[model samples]
Target: MVKYLVVFEKTETGYSAYVPDLPGCIATGKTKNMTEKHIIEAIQFHIEGLIEEKIKIPISKTEADTFVFALK
Candidate 1:
């Protein structure tokens, strides 16, 4: 199974998520957990659609890192 990097962002109204490797695949939910679930579903659906269309599935090249800075 291919693992894609998914990003979750907090919005004013709710949480939103998207997969960097799978363009146009995104989802939103009321909570972080819900958003995670929705994103998983979105990824599956996206892959199924790609398979149906016989499109080549893109590889995962997205990586994430966290940085912290001190404020004075």
Candidate 2:
């Protein structure tokens, strides 16, 4: 199985998510958990559609990290 980096953002009403490797693949929900579920389903559907169309599936190359900073 292939893995893709997903970005989640907090919105005014709820949460939103998207797959960086797959453009146009996105999901939103009332809660983080719900958004996570929806995103998972969206990823699967996106891949399936690509496969059906015989399009090349993008490789997962995006990575993310967090760093803490202190103010003096």
Best by lDDT: 2
lDDT of 2 at 10: 99
lDDT of 2: 0.97
Tens digits of lDDT, candidate 2, 21-59: 999999999999999999999999999999999999999
Alpha carbon deviation, residue 26, candidate 2 (Å) = 0.4
Task: Give each prediction's root-mean-square deviation over alpha carbons.
Answer: 0.6, 0.7
Model 2 CA deviation exceeding 4 Å by range: none
Q: Residue 1, candidate 2: how far off, in angstroms? A: 0.8
lDDT of 1: 0.96
Candidate whose TM-score is highest: 1
Residue-by-residue lDDT tens digits, candidate 1, 9-31:
99999999999899999999999
lDDT of each: 0.96, 0.97
